[model samples]
Each structure stands twice: as C-alpha cells, then as structure tokens.
Target chain A: MKKILLPVLILALVIQLFVPSYMIWQRYDVLKSGTEVKFDIGLFDPYDAFRGRYVSIRVEDAIATSFVRGRYGILEIDENGFAKISRVESEPPKEGLYLISSEENYFSFPHNRYYMEETLAPEAEKVIGASAEAYITVRIKNGKSVISGMYIGDVPIEEYLTE
Target chain B: MRKEKWLLDEIEKWQTEEIISPESAEILKTRYAPKKKINLLIVLFSIIGTLFVGMGVVLVGAHNLWYKLPIAARTAIGFLPLVASQVLVLYVYLKKRDSIAFCEGAAILNMAGVFSSVAIVGQIFHLPSDFTNYILLCGVLALPSMLILNAIAPLGIYFWTVLNGGLCFDSLWETPLSTALYVVGALFAIYNFRAENGRAVYVAWISVISGFILVWVTSLLEDFDVFISLFAYFALLGSASVLWERAGRSLEISGTAGTLIVMLFATYEGWWLSSIKSDITIAVLTLAFLALAIGILIKKQRVVPAALAAFAALLLRAIWALVGLNSEPFSVVFMIVANVILLAVGVYYIWAGARKVSLLYANVGMITVCTLIIMRFFDSEMSLGIRGVVFILLGIGFLGFNSYLVRMRKKAKEEK
Candidate 1:
C-alpha cells in the first residue's frame, strides 16, 4: 500500500486542478440575487438601509389566532423547520391543513408550504433569538413564495401596502 | 490428552519443515548481501536537500534581494536559481540513478521554485492577477517534472494553479467557490493509499492549508446559509471519506463534522422525511444504502462507518416523514420501536464483530454507532443545558475511548 500511495496521491491532486467551476458561479448568482436586488414583500432587517423602516410580516400559524387584513395565503413550517408560503387551501383547517396547489416548486418562492409553530402577535417578541421576529421575504419571481428572513413586529399588511 | 496430542503433532510438523536444502541456504544468503549498492538513496537525498536550499534562497530573496533587483532582473533571476539547482539534480540523477534519498521531495521542491518564479514574474510584469493564467503557466513548466521526476511536488504546483484559476476566472470564487475548492483540495491532501509516513504528508498539509484558504475565500463571497453550507459540508465529508479509506489518514473528525453539517442541513431543508413521502422510495433508498454498507464491510473498507451513519440518518428521516404524513397516535410509537430495533441490531453487530474480527474496523463501526446515537439524542427535545452537557460527555467519551484503544493497539503491535 505504501508503494502505490505516492502515485495515487499525485493523481488525485492533478485531477482536482481541473474540476468544473460551474457550482461556484451558480452560488454567486444566488448571492447576488439575494442581497443587491432588494424587492421587499414583507421581511426586513432593521439595518436594511433601503427600505426606510423594518417591514412587518404576516405569520402563518396553524391555530389561526390572529388575522391579516389581506393575506395572500398561509404558509406552513415544513419538517425541516423552513416556513414555506403556500396558498391556504381551506379557511383555518380544523385538523392538519391541506396545502393549496401553487403550481410552483416548494424550493422556489411563491409556492412552498410553511406552517407556523407559534403565533406572532403585533409588537410581540418576533423571534426566540435577539432578532425582532421571523418574517418571510416574498418575491414574485417565477411565482411567489416567502424567502425566510429576519423577524419583525406584526403590523397591518394594509399599512405596509399603502406605504 | 488433546493438548499433548496437538503439541506432538506440532513438533513432528516443525521437524519436517526445519530441514533446509543447500541451494535454499545459498539463495537466502545471496538475498541478504550487504555489498548490494543502494546509491539511489544518496542521489535522492542530495536532490531533495538542494531543492530545499533552493526554496530557502527564494524565500530569503523574496524578503531581501527581490526588492533590490530590477523587476525584470528579478524575474530572470528566478529562472537562474532553479536552473542551477536542476543542473545539480540532473547530474546526480544521471550519474547515480540507483541511489536517491527521497525522490518526491526533490520534485516538489523543484516545482515550488518554478511556480514562485512564474507567479513573481507575472506579478512584476503587471500581468492579470487571474488565477487560471498563473496555473496554465505553472502547469506547462512543471509538466516535465510530473513525467520525468516521478515526484509529488509538481502535483502541489498543479493544485495551486487550478485553485488560482478558479479564484481569478470564476466569479463564484468570490462566493461559494472558495469554500467548494477548499473542500476539493482537502480531499486530495488526505488521500493516502499506502504508508502513512512519507513525503506525501507535506503535500497533504499544503492541500489542507489551501482548503482553509478556500473556506475563507467563500466567506467573502456571501453570507452563510444553513442549507448551502450544509450541502458544501456534505460534499466535503463524502470526499473526505474516500480520502480516509484510500490513505488510512485519520480524517474522521472532518468526515464526522461534514456528515453532521449535511444531516443538519437536510433536516432544515425538510428533506429528511423525503423517504417517508414515498414508502417505495424509502425502502429503495434504505436497501441501496444497506447494500453499500455491506459491500464496504465485506471488503473491510474504512468507509463503512460513513456509509452506515448515512444509512441511519436516512432511516430516521424516513421515519420522521411517516409520522408527519400519518397522524395516527401510534405513529410516533412505531417510529421509536423501529429505530430502537435497528439500533439494537447495529450495536450487537458492532460489539460481536469487535470480539471476533479485526479491532480497527470494529472500532470504526462502534464509533459510527456512537456518533449516530449522539446525533439523534441532540435532535430530540432535550433542554439546552442538558444537551450541552451530553455533548461534552460524548466528546470526552469518544476521545478517551479512542486514546485507550490506540494505546492498546500499539501495544499489541509491539508484542506481535
């Protein structure tokens, strides 16, 4: 084994010198799309300079404790803990909520299903962490779904829409 | 009576085999001849020493003389230092092909000088700091050494070239590319197919540092996301497993971390329960993974632990999915039962195997089982303080066990 290790190592090293660079390129495109082109749907970072104030969001909770004045749909927290926004199939499901067919891949925005583990009352603690609250970044790209973002206070959607 | 019979049988067999022929004795004596020349070791060492001195000079010159010399002259002088070293190497190589101290070292050293020179020259000439171009130039120059010197050094240069190419040419290098490349480089570095001790270790270390650089580069590219980062971690872990198996290098830490990262990422992605979404898919994936584990184990491969851990995680994901889909009261009960059974079987096999088979592989299996158990426990609804305490205990346990096992194994080897 010792005899052949040298050549084997060299071969591996050389091969690495030529792997495709496509993965890296694609990652950059994703990063650029996220940071530079700011299209505000709901989610906001207080430090997000362009969007004057912290954007409030409509939390999609299972209990349906509170109401959004004009909600696009309900989102569900997937088992993976990501809150994907999907159309509310039935108004406030009694049992487990059935997700509305958004005709978009769950991985992409404007289609994924998100379930809220807890309710977000207005001016309440938005997150379990130091962040204000958890809200979604809704982009109408390719369809519409919430990109998970920092939490903020619950505000009337009507107020933000008018602004 | 049986022991005495066995001893009598052994004595008879020994007496029969102990008779040595005259021709056999002559052949054995000839094979052990001290007069046999091994001049290759001397030549190899000379070349290696010269290469190291050359590198030292370059480092010194870079600090001192390089600044004083005209940029053009500095560029030209790079060639001179290397050329002088190469001339000496070639002379010895030609004169004493049979004796070499460490051939790979010389090759690596040779390319190190060459690459430094080219990179420096390119810098002086105001050439585009593009990584790919630098790699291309280095690749062309070092190409001969790869073929002729039979050294691993040129490979090091080649790696730098490729890595630089990605950094300069690929915009992704500014983002995930750096992380991705670092992962790729680290995999190459730990790839030892034979003896653990050799000149290749240095190359492997270089690869590791480069990988760290890659990680740093990627950080500059974008903000860290759990999913993408985990994906990268998984890729690194998978490759690291291969390195572990091939080189027998102790990369279990990276491998374990990588696997954990990926699993966490997958859980966050909500793909953990993907198998449960379709029972057939779950069954097929499980079978596939089990098959892989069995295959590895059959071959006594080092990567069996990695495969097993992956299989266990996938199994858990499948169970979680089923529980989600079927809101029956007994769903969780069934899931728990299934995991318990599987864990029991796995532990039994690992323990039994340890007692009967080779300890190295058995130790790996045990470690893997323990890791999975720890991972699952952490995923459960435990308090933060409790979980932290558990994690600390597990870490200490692992360290202690491995340390004790290593000592035992070493002692056994010495006794043998």
Candidate 2:
C-alpha cells in the first residue's frame, strides 16, 4: 500500500492538472487563432451550484430551419456580421467553422453561457438584453468555440456597466 | 483529555480493588495516554486556515478580480494550490503517515485545491454552469488521492459528491460509464477500508445507499409510475439494511426514511384508487425485504426495524396488486389503519427501547413518535395558536422523558 501510494497520487495529480490546463489551452488556442464573429443574442439569469451565477445565452435569430440529429451545423457570417447556421452536415466544413449537435433541435455551441461576477451578472444581463444591437463575440476554430465577450453596439458590455 | 483521565482513574481504582495486575493496568493506561492539546490545536488551525485560503481564492475568482489578468495567469494561479496540495498530501503520505490529523488535514486541503483549480478555470474561461460535469470531474479525479493519502475526509467528500452527481445530473450521467466510475470508487474504498475502522465503514454504507442510484437508475422506466418504482427501489434498500453489519446503521436509517415516504403515500386515496401498474420488481423486492426483515427480527430481536420493513412490504403488495385487479381492496379504512400503525410503531419503539435499557433505542422511539405526530400538523385542522401550544407541550414532554431515561441509565450504571 505504501509503495503504490506516491505513484497513484502523481497519476491523479497529472490528470487533475491536465484537465483544467487542457481546457484553458483549448480555449486559449481558439481565442488566439480562430475566426471571431458576433452572434445576435439575449441573456436570462441562471444559477449553477458550482459555477455560481451566469446569464444563459439565448440566440435571437433562427438557429436552424432544419436540424438533423447527430449532425454538425456549419455557421456563416450574415450580411449584418452576425453568425447564422447555414447548413447541417454529417461532416464539418473542410476549411470553415462548425458546431456539433448530438441532440436534434438543440444546436450545441460552447458560447451558450457567459459567466460574470456574482452580483454583476444579473445587472449586466438587464443592460445588455435591452439593447437592440446586443451580441455575443465568439471565436471559433475547427469546431471549438470560446465566448470572447458580450457586447452592445461594438462596446463591451462591461464598459457600460457600473463595476 | 477528559476520557483519558477518567480511564486512568478507573485503571487506578481497578488496581486498588485488585481487579487486574499492575502490568495490565499499565498497558491500559498506555492505550489511553492523553493526546497533546497543542498538537490538536495546530491540526485544527491548519485545516481551518487552508479552508479560508482556498475559499478566499475561489471567491476572488468568482468576483472576476482576475478578469484583467491574462487567462494564462489566472489558470496558472488556479493550478498553484492544486500542485502545492498534491505535494502536501505526498509529504503526509511519506512522513506523517501515522497521524490521522495530518492525513485528514492533507485530504481537506487537497480537495479544496482540486475544487478551486477547476472553479478558477471555469471562472476565467466563462465555462458554463454544468455542475454535473464539473463536480463529477472533481470527484473522479479526487477519488484516487483519498485512497493514496488514506484519509477519511476525502472518502466522505467523495461519497457526498457521488450523491450530488446522481441528484443533479438526473439521467444525464446515468450511462454505463458513470455507474462504472462509482463501482470503481467503491472498490477503491474497499481496498483501503478496514472492517474495524468505524468511519470508513460508515461512509461505505452511506455511499451504497446513495451512490448506487437504486432510485434514479429507473430512467428507462418511462411507462412505470415513479412512486410505485420508488417502492421497489426503496424495498431493495430496506433489504440491504439487513446486510448483517455491512449496512447495519446507514441502510436502517435510509430504509426507514423510504418506508415513511411510501407510508405517507399509502395514506392518500389516489394512491389506492389510481390505475398505476407496478411491475414484477416490486413483488421481488417486497419478498426480499420481508425475508430479510423477518431474519433480522429472529436473529437480532429488533422489532421496530423489522416492523418498518414489514410495513414497506405491505405497501409493495397493495401497489403490486393494482396491476392485476381493478378492485381497490385498500380503502379509506386502510388510510386510518396506516396512520394507526405508524403511531403504534412509534409507541412500540419506545416500549422496546425502555425494556432493553438502551438510550439509543428509546431516543429513536421518542423522535419517531414526535416526528409522526408533527407530520400530521399539515393535514390536521388545528389553528396555528393551538399547534404552537402542542409544539411546546411536545418539547416539554421530550425533555421530561429524556431526563427520566438519563436518570434510569445513571442508576443502572451505579448498581452495576
């Protein structure tokens, strides 16, 4: 039991450290290299027991007219520079960005949650939600998407709020 | 300290009275040697300090104080405590292995670090509030550290985490892999667990009662009434309570709680009149629980637990019969009878407890009767003022009975 203890602890430590590091690296990579686009969205307050408070992202425009279960949604920048689901396919676009959805109708996007400081989130949501030009800035690479920031009329929402 | 002093005094008395030799008395004294207060204080402060530090970091992250910092920096800071605690646990493992306080302290810090690492990352990266995923990841990763460090704190935390995972995830993590993860956890616990270690065994039993997800695993049964299925699942747990010492306490409490729930449902008219078809699982579990309860009654001479188990079995039978026959043999009289039986069971517990001179049994009986009566407040048409009076009366009665039992126990001990 004594001999095996250190090796097992190290193994667990590596996995534990690896998970969060990998997550950070993955998001970091996406934000650094991926195509940045805005998506017209609204927010409603929601609470997570572990992650604390956040605004739940609600995409404004129609995500998809038709969704196939276990298919990927290929998104394209519309005329207004807001991302819209252009097509659903079995394979992700060879050169462009795509989002995977295993469950039909529910389009899987990593940018569906915008976390904020505990007391600041609900107030931020109220301000950002009322704006006509409210959008979520997301960076997408390969298939991974990271929420860069929430915005109103090209100004970061945090700039408009009282800290 | 007090216990050690008392034991030493008792040993001296035994020696003077010539109950044992000086050598034997010396050995007894050595076994109960007083633990140093300073060492205990150090351990407590270390644990409390670590907790505060961890919570402070997480709270800072929650407030987005690190928002201005590069994500890399926030991530780095997050991993710092985790790395430090990982090393701390290893140090305890190699040097302070004999110290339970050290092991527990390391375990607590290690868990806090693990949580903060993930939480800060989640905070920095705007990770969605997928608590199920976050907690399960923490629990699964932290599980091995508990076994490696040989600490009860982590074991307790692991069990609680598994329970939360089951409840919060709903049917999301109910896949084969999640169940397999829990099975592996139990196996690891068994590997580390000694049957004699009271805390290890207690946590193990609680984990089985919750981690196995006997109740939540029925996500596949869409056609079945969840309430009827609860009877089957709870019957399964109730039978497990009689696993002869493995689940003796945890299962008894859990099984009794389940029985109470089903008993409450049985008192309702819709439960009997409704056309809910309970499957064969109910019958099988009811029989199993009945057999186990009867066995316990015969072997241990414990009547209340067996009686509660028997009541659960009867509920299962009536529910199961709804499948084959449209006749509602269980009626309003059955409702009255169920309430009466609950009251009777509580009274029986008090009687049996007093007869055995066991305060645990008597107190359990007292609480049982009090709880049963208090539960009736919602349905009873008593005014708020009257209910307050009843509450006061029950409180006084409880204190009076408790004092009487304490006096009797003291007298019996003195006589002995």
Candidate 3:
C-alpha cells in the first residue's frame, strides 16, 4: 500500500503544480509578446475571503456598450491609447481582442481587479481615485489578454500608492 | 478513565456472578486496562502554536513586503514557509511517524503554507481575482498533501471552498466545473472510507453540499415544467439520504434535515394552487417520495419518524389539492391535520427510542413535538385565550409523556 501510495501522491502533486505554473507561464508569454492596450478605469476596494483584498476596476469602454448574452463586442483603441466598444459582434473578431459579456452584462476582461494587501488596498484605491488619469494596461494575444499593470499618467499605480 | 473504571467494576460483578471463569476475567481486565497515551495538552499547544506562526507568515506576505525586496530575495521569502513546512512533514514522516501529534501538526502547517504560498504568488504577480480559478488551484494543490498527510481540516476547507466557488462563480447551473468537483469529492470520500482514517465524514459533507448546490443550479437554469424542478429537488434529497447512508451519521442527519426543510417549503399554498398540472405533478411526486421513505424505514428498521412525518404531510397536502379544496378553511383544516400527524409521529418516536434505549431518537422526537406545537400557536387564527389554553395543555402533556418514558425505562432495567 505504501509503495503504491507514494507514486500516486507524487503524480497528483506534479499535476497540481503544473496547472498553476502553466497558467502563469501562459500569461507571462502573452505579456512578453501581445499588443498592449490601455483603458481608463474606476476603482473600488472589496474584500474576498479566498482572494484576500482587491481593488475592483470598472473599464469605461467595457461598460459603455449594451451586450447580448454569449456574444462578443469589438473594442477600438484611440490615439490616446484608451479603448471603447466599436460595435457588438455575434462571433469572435477576425483579428483583434474582443470583450465577451454574460447575460447580466459582466465582461470577462483580461483583468477585473488588482489584488493587494488588506491594509493597503484602501490606500491604493484612494490613490487611483485621486489621480487625474488612471488607466489599466492589458496585453492581448490571439484573443487572450493579461493585465500588465495599472498606470497613473504613465507611472505604475503601485509606485505612487506605496510611496 | 471513566470507561476503564466502569469496565473494571462490570468485570468484578461478572466474576462474582460466575458469568466467566477466573482466567477469562483476568484476560478481560488486562485487555480493558488503559495504555500510556500522548499528552493531550502538548498536542493542543503544538497545533495552536503552528497555526499562529503560519498565520503570521501569511500576514507578512499580505503586507506586500515582496515589492520592496529584490527578485531573488522576494522569491526566497515567498517560498520559504512552504519549503520549511515540507521539510518538517518529511522529518516527522521519517522519524516520528508513529506520533499523531507531530504528524498532524506538521501536516496542518504544510496545508497552511500551501495557501499562503498561493496567495503570495498571486499577489506578487498581480493575478486577477477570479475566485473560482483561485479555489480550484488551491484545492488541487492542497488535496495531494491532504491525502499524503491524512489531514482532515485542510480536506474540509478545500471542500467548502469548492462549494462556495461553484455557488458564487457558476451561472445558470451550467457549471461543469462544479459537477467535476462533486465527483472528485465523492471519490476522495470513498478513498478515505477505504483507508479507514475517519476523515470520510468531511468528504461526505462536501458531496452533500455540492449535490444540493447542483440541484439548486439546475432548478434555476433549466426552463422546466412548474413542478418538475420541485420533484427533482425532492428526488435528489431522497436519493442522497438512501445512497450516502454508509458515508457517516452526519450525512444521514443532513439528508433527513434537508428532506424535512424542502417538504416544509413545499407545503406553501402557492405550490399546491399554482396550476392544475402543477398540482397533479406535485401530488404524484409526493406519493412517490412517501413510498420511498417507507421503503427506507422498513429496510433500515430505524425510527426516523421525522422523515416519515415530513413525507406524510407532503402527501396529505397533495391529497388536499386532488380533492379540489381551494378554500382558506380547507387549507387550515389540512394544516391542522398535518400538525396532529406530526405530533403523533413524534410521540411514537419518543416511545420507540425509550424502548430501545436510544437517546438520539428520543431527543429528536421531543424537539419535533415541541416545534410543531409552537408552530400551531403562530399558524392558527384561534383567539388568544384559546391558544394560551392549548399551549398549557400541550406543555403538560409533554411533561407527562416524558415522565411515562422514564418510568418505562426504569421498569425495563429492573426487569433486566
């Protein structure tokens, strides 16, 4: 029993580690190669039991469009590097990253919120809110997107919030 | 120690009565003698101390200290607790494998380290706050260690996390991930049962909770005929009660409670008067569940009178619907009959438990009787004076019934 159990435990552990590592690695790969887009965001802080404290972000462009359930919306970036929904599409776009919304109009963007320390999350929120310009930088590749960082007028929000 | 003393006294009495030979008595005494045991105080302190230290590490990580440190140093800091916990568990496994306190303490610390590491890694990398993904990742990472360590606490935490993830993240009951999780939990439960580690109860609870969530999700997401979802919910509860009986007592208790609660919910007038089609479907399903409950009772030969009473009440309400009695007075009459039946079943359970010397059944029966009588006081439209009189009479009757059971028990013991 012991002989059989050890191998099985090792195998399960390998699989467990492989999943999260693979997901993180995939996001890393996207950030390394994908197109970067910025969107202005409104911030609020909420506490989740499992995910700790996070600053919830609302993308102005993603919220502007009326979305049908199970459909994708096309987003276009302007010269200022801010994005907005150009039109709602029934299928995935031919070349660009698109937003998919649920029946309740919740979109699964590359990043919805930034997780931080519980004590510091409110401070982050306050700093983001105080900034005249707050934008989220996302990297999109092959229809998948990963959030790189939050920026307050070109400086990472973490730098300002920490100081 | 109390049990040991009682056993010694019983052995002495048996020897005096010549129930066993002198040699047999000596063997019994030797077998019943308590063995040297680990100090429970030490075990308690060790567990508590490890938990506090683990929480401290998590708090340090939560402070975003990783941001200030160099990449190499931050990586080491993030992974240090996890590696330390692993080393501790390995040492315990190799050197103190026979010590339950050391083994469990190391295992608990390892579990905590796993969660803290995941949270730290997520925070440092600025991962999105997708609870479903986070919980699934945690469960996968923790489950293997839990199995290896035979740790029940982490296993229970993982199960509840899966449950919350499914309820919060999944929409329209189309959560294939939750379904997969339920299957995983059931498999783990079976594995624990085979291992005989007494941790199967946690897994069984997970299965029950996940099963209920699945039913709720299905009810909400599917566009079904009116009573079909209701029937399906009851069927799920009935099947769970019958199927998971071997899991543990907790599952059995939960199953019974779930059945009763759903049945009580169904007794609302809206359920019966929704439509003729709905009324007919509810009536048929009630009869089916009643038959199933009776079959279970007969096979088990256990006095689960609460389940029986619930099924019977649902059946009565269905029968009332069939009779086309949609009047307010008729509904009141049906409620009264249901309460009376509940009271009678409770009394029967109390009597049966006393006869068999089973305290759990008797206590449940007593609570049921009290609850039903109190419900009547609120549910009925009787005058205040009449209701007060009814309450007093019922209280006296309950006292008399309890005294009767006590006397009966005494007589039985004396006869023995």
Scoring each candidate complex against the real one, what DockQ results?
0.01, 0.45, 0.37
Give the interface-residue alpha carbon RMSD of model 1.
20.5
**Candidate 3: CAPRI quality band:** acceptable
Predicted candidate 3 versus true structure: per-residue lDDT over B1-416, tens digit per residue: 88898999999999999999999999999999866566767766776787787777777667664465643465567667777877776677567777756866776777677667777667655676665666666675666666676655455566666666666655424566765765676576656643333345655666567666655544344433333334333433444354444454655566556644554444344444443333343345445645676676668675444455555654665566457665676765665565566667667767877888889768766876766655555753456897688789988987997899799989999999
Residue B324 Cα positional deviation in candidate 3, in Å, after optimal superposition: 8.4
Clashing pairs in 2: none
lDDT of 2 by residue, B102-211 (tens): 87778777787888788877877776556766777888877777776666556656755665665554642345556566666666655443444455456656565554
- The CA lDDT at A72 in model 2 is 74
Q: Which clashing pairs does model 3 show? A: none
Q: Sort every candidate by TM-score, greatest first.
A: 2, 3, 1
True contacts kept of each: 0.00, 0.49, 0.23
lDDT of 1 by residue, A1-163 (tens): 5456445535533432322122222322333353211121232222111101222333344322233232234455455344443444334344432332222222112222221211222222233234433344332221122232232345432223224
The list of candidate 1 runs beyond 4 A from truth reads A1-163, B1-55, B60-75, B96-102, B153-157, B167-192, B195-305, B311-416
Q: Rate the local accuracy (lDDT) of all candidates.
A: 0.43, 0.67, 0.64
Ignoring the other chain, what TM-score does chain B have in each prediction? Answer: 0.49, 0.64, 0.65
Question: Ten residues in a row with the worst lDDT in model 1 chain B?
Answer: B122-131
lDDT of 2 by residue, A8-43 (tens): 778887888898888888889988998888888877
